[model samples]
Target chain A: MKNEIKIFSPATVANVACGFDVLGFCLDTIGDEMVIRKTEENGIKITKIEGYDLPFEAEKNVAGVSALAMYNALQPDCGFEIEIYKKIKPGSGIGSSSASAAGSVFGMNELLGKPLNNTELTNFAMKGEALASKCEHADNLAPAIFGGFTLVKSACPLKVLELPTPPDLFATLIHPQIEVKTSESRAILPKEIPLENAITQWANVGSLVHGLHTSDYNLIKESLTDVVIEPYRKQLIPHFDDVKSAVLEAGALGCAISGSGPSIFALSKSEATAKAVQLSMQNAYSKSNIQFETYVSKINTQGIKTL
Target chain B: MKNEIKIFSPATVANVACGFDVLGFCLDTIGDEMVIRKTEENGIKITKIEGYDLPFEAEKNVAGVSALAMYNALQPDCGFEIEIYKKIKPGSGIGSSSASAAGSVFGMNELLGKPLNNTELTNFAMKGEALASKCEHADNLAPAIFGGFTLVKSACPLKVLELPTPPDLFATLIHPQIEVKTSESRAILPKEIPLENAITQWANVGSLVHGLHTSDYNLIKESLTDVVIEPYRKQLIPHFDDVKSAVLEAGALGCAISGSGPSIFALSKSEATAKAVQLSMQNAYSKSNIQFETYVSKINTQGIKTL
Candidate 1:
């Protein structure tokens, strides 16, 4: 079937709260769309963008790499004409790069009669992420491919599981007008952590996992606190802790830095709490009087889909 | 109220195979007893064992310290005559010391009209373990206090939860006749793990907790793997890999070191599989000219109770 397959890939919050390097959840706020059509060309060629500018080169671009990886897995000779519409910004830290990669793989696989399982597709998408980040970390790729709250159990062989996300789970994303490079933020983390801090991190990670599975909002709030990474990364975001505090005071379940960011995610149990959280975020940045965008979204259960 | 109280504290597997610092489970096979009398001495006193040359001094003996800690917490100026009857072997790596400490707290708390919560009594029991090992680790104390499979959510504040045990779950313990000093075993573990390994550990920890809460047997088996700790500790246990192979080959779901020890545990789905596992362990050790004692046990639900 050499037909057009249009797919949607949701934005994701990687390094979800306490689960650094292992957890993420899809966001319903924004996503990217990719249309893959079988073409006569020898390789994947990304055609056009509906919004922002992204590389269209076959080998250099993330979407192109993602399509190539999938094609190589099944039929290396199959050519794909991929058109990507980037709704999420390229450097936005809300899994910007993953959306393109996920959309490409998802659309291409659908067009090709669906040969790969979600895990296999995740592996292909992860390769695309690896091409851009120079490392195969599955934190972003899992949620983008499988949706819901996801955990990348292993990055090497790519074991991604869709965990049971809490019902009434709402997320508020506040992206301040600032650029924080993912590479730079990652490099800033200390190469070695004190043994005491490592133990504490693992304990919190355990608790967070428990909270997520049990839907214990209070435990999740307690578990979201990062004593090791966020302290260092918050220096990059103006009014970071203030924003967190304000949202929490406004009845957020928990709040923490959303990836390597000028953005932060606050969890709330209800739409009203989410609205209050949105206002709190605006007020926190009002001191700097900086313009910021806020998104009140239900946790995205349908990750990447054909649109 | 002056009364005779008989309390039974179950022996526990501290390290819980995969979860080195964060998990443990109580077992019914072995334990100790402490009989506390409301004496008018106005201070805590330890009466030594009938046969063995165990410590009798208040600060030096584990049971005495536990009783004293409870007294200090509750009455602050009361007398306790604690008699120790240690049944769990001294260096079994099956939380023998924890049994004594927990038994002391259980006996005295009953005698003191239960003035403390389980958490509070656990805190008191931990003081005894601290005095015994000179290290403040809670793997043993958690299960001994709470029973079933337990998770140590926090160390500083001592948060412990009793996780549900699956009905089909069975464990086969193989205590090889060898002595590996707890301190030496502890020293062999690496101080730092790759961030990747740490993340995988947490993912499994989450799955394990979920498995317990939902009674998912396969999930429990899947979660019972150690990528961070067991690989390093294998050196201390002779024929470790071979024993694990034997256990698994005999249809055991999972197997690993029981604690900081010369003992190992294999979990299975049925009594037959458990018996097969026992034979497998015995066969593996016998091939290496080593003797081992094996016990098959279901998860203990009642932690410390009057026997």
Candidate 2:
């Protein structure tokens, strides 16, 4: 087996529009780089972390927590060392913690000669995710691991389905540098929603999945609506409606808050349109004096890759 | 255009498992037959009825109501007369009323030289459906018009999507000879449902649509679950759990109440398995002394067809 491996783990957008907590997709060009080394000694350690101020303790850190979970289960003959070169920002709502959580296990699994499947890896990664978000979730991690679009069909059983990615679809994301805690964002949601609205939400999800499979752009545009989540969560993000309208006016197929808020993502049929969408989002928020970063990329079909 | 047309409008299984009020499919070899004839008279009429006691008034009967809806929209050069050969029994929960409503507009549109498309036909059919169910719904009508599996993606400004049908899939339906009114079933449901359950429901719907598009039987089985409406509505059906267990034990891919209830449907991977599922459903209900009718049929890719 290889003694070490360097890999790229992609960022992901969870709670995709009408999908709420169930759907997410990965980005190809945006993510974190990690190096996993099979150490001579006997335990897991976070040797280095860069780009952002984060904990280096193995148990307290997201990446270390995930690596430790997998290590404890496998009981490998050798200890491991992890180095995270972070690029995705925390509290950005584009699944920054998930990228960290998934990258560690993915790199370690490769170093261990691929002992675990995506589902098994996701469970371990979710353990790490829970530490950061206060709840175990797979929507972000599944896409970060499996690539493309993923549906966390059931949380308890942890069923994750990898949905198809339309060939021409490109995602444009704008992250307004703002802190929107996942827990507080979750608190504002109503415990119960009208049954009629629920039906509309599911119907949109059903059609959206179909749209992806068939590469029907019109259907995707029509189905990319969130009646259950966005109406409430949009309140937390400044210029949410303006950005959404701007992207739609820029010819985006669909647009919505990426995960919880602060970051917004829009899907368009071409790279040109995606870039145009980025400019529109820029225009929408630039005047508001909110510092932001934008990215335009195709759907990542390969989750974590050896570098 | 033909002066007269005789058509078979297939019975549909709506509220399909996880896709409440959104998903449905047409069943071959099971439906109602109607003969629609263009007449010199400038109005619509229901000339003959057979096999059931039903209203013959042009505006009162579902077929007449749907035909009149289309007739009024077109104000065609001629009137039409409809003769019903109703085979799907009313209050059977197998979209009996939808079959009738769809059949008339389908036959009338044929005689009128295909003036309108499936979406237009669905809109007219939903009007008649509203007369029977006291609500405008397209789950049943959409599939009956579009053929195969369909998702009623939106109710207002009705957008219906025709989803791909898996080749090996077969349906087994059991209609218990008991009354389960749509309104009563609707009354039993809570106006608001837990947000958590709604998430589960939409996740299943998203996966189920994926499964159908990819023809993944295992994914289909896993996704064929209803967490929102089934729990409350299944109570109105006799021996719902017993029959479900029986069908699942017989190697059926999935099972759920067809539409509102009293009728249950199971999907299997093959015609043989579907027949076996029917037998299992028979055995489950046979001991209870409930009069029932069972059917095994492939998906009707051709919705309303000429007889």
Candidate 3:
């Protein structure tokens, strides 16, 4: 058995337009890297944190917390140490914390001879997310751990389902250099939504799942509309409407706030259109004097893999 | 061009458990039939009605209204007369009105040399639904017209998407001899839904769509749970909980009130299980001294076809 392992977990876009808190997809370009090694001690330790300022305490850091959860579940006498290199920035609304959390558990699972399945790893990773966001949600963590498009059927038992993705599908992500606290963004949403809007939202979600399975571009385009959450969450993001309109005009199939806000993403049929969407979105934000970074990528078919 | 055509439109189960007003599916056993023949006159006439008492006027009856809509759209310089044979009774919550409405448009489309596509046909059929329920909704009408599992992406422009169905999937429908007014059932639901409940509902809807496409029975079972609509509508149906429990215990994958109520449907993996569910549900209702009819069928892949 391997005593040490290195793994990478991709970033995820949660909500996927109309499927708020239920749908997410992995990204190929941006993610977090974790190196996990078995140690003589009986607990988890965080040896290093790079690329971003994050907690080093095993219990406090997301990656370390996830690793510890996996270790405890295995009940192995040996301890583990985790080193995280974060590429996905926190509060970008692109599942930064989830990559760290999922990567840690995934790496530990490999080092321990694969004691847990992907769903169980996702469950442990969700605990890490709970530590960060004050709630346990698998929308981001499931995709980060399982790859591709993922649907969280239920969070209680943590049923994660992998969905089909068209081979030609591409994504454009624009991360503005701003922070929209996930908790604050969530708090801004209404506790109750009009029953009609709820119906529309579920309709879009069902259509989106159907579109992904069938690789129907027109269906995806029609299903990307958000009538419930986006109308409320977009207020926290700067230039939300202008950037969305620009991306749509630039031939993007759909655009929406990535998760909570401060970051936006668009899906396209080809890499060329995705690049054009990136340029259009960047220009829109620049016109408003907002600094942002853009990444264009194909949908990540491999969620977490060995490095 | 053929001057006369006959078509059959399948019965539909809307809501599909968790996807209220968004998802629906067709059944093989129950439906409505219409015969349309072009006439020298300039409009539409409902010359006959059978199996149920419905308005004979072109504008008042669902079938006649739908046929008139198709006639107006074609402007074929000819009138059409329709004869309706309804097997799916109205107020059964099994999409009786939708069957007549969809059947009328489908038959007229055939008589007019296919002037309109399925979406356009669905639009006219929705007008028929509006005549009965006073609201233009197509959850039932789309599936009745299109066949198989369907997702209504949007209602304004009438975007309908057909989803894949598993080959072995069977349905058991136990329609008690009772009437649950669609309008009143809808009115009983709250105008606003809790945001948390909405999230659960959409998650289930997304999963159900994924399950049907991928043929994952467990996923379908998990996704059939309803936390938003059924809790409110079940009260209108007598012994709803007992019937549901009985069906589930009898090897059904999932069970719920069909459409708005008075009819209950269960999904199973095999024909035998479906029949078993039918018996269990019928027995449960019998104990309550309620009269009902039962049907066991494979999913109707052919939504509207000539007999």
TM-score leader: 2
> For residues B221-296, what per-residue lDDT tens digits would candidate 3 score against the true structure?
8889889988899999998899899999999999998989889999999999999998898889888777889999
lDDT for each residue of candidate 3 in A187-261, tens digit (9 for 90 to 100): 889999999899888888888888888898978887898899888889888889999999999999999989887
Cα TM-score per model: 0.90, 0.98, 0.96
DockQ, per-model, please? 0.46, 0.92, 0.88
Name the lDDT of candidate 3: 0.88
For candidate 2, write residues A1-307 as lDDT tens digits.
Answer: 7899999999999988999999999999899999999988988999999999999999999999999999999998899999999999999988899999999999989888899999999999999999998889988999999999999988788888888898999999999988888888999999999999999999999989999888899999998999989988999999999999999999999999999978999999999999999999999999898799999999998888899
lDDT by residue for model 2 (B1-307), tens:
6899999989999988999899999999899999999999989989999989999998899888888888898999899999999999998988899999999999988887788999999999998998898889999998899999999988889999999999999999999999988889989999999999999899889998999988999999998988888889889988999999999999999999999988999999999999999999999999987899999999999898998
Best by lDDT: 2
After the best TM-score superposition of candidate 1, give how far the Cα of residue B72 lies from its true spot, in angstroms: 2.6
Q: If ranked by DockQ, best first, what sequence of candidates would result? A: 2, 3, 1
- For model 3, the superposed segments whose C-alpha errors exceed 4 Å read B1-3
iRMSD (1 decimal) for each model? 2.3, 0.6, 0.8
lDDT of 3 at B228: 93
**Weakest lDDT window of 10 consecutive positions for candidate 2 chain B:** B106-115
Residue B113 Cα positional deviation in candidate 1, in Å, after optimal superposition = 4.9
Best by DockQ: 2
> TM-score ranking from best to worst?
2, 3, 1
lDDT of 1 by residue, A1-307 (tens): 6479877788889877777888788998678877888886767887887788767786888888877887876875568888878888777778888888778888877877888888888878877887777887778888888889886766766666668888987999898878888888888887655445555666677677777777888778778877767878899888998998899899998888887777799888888899899999988888896777888888888888776
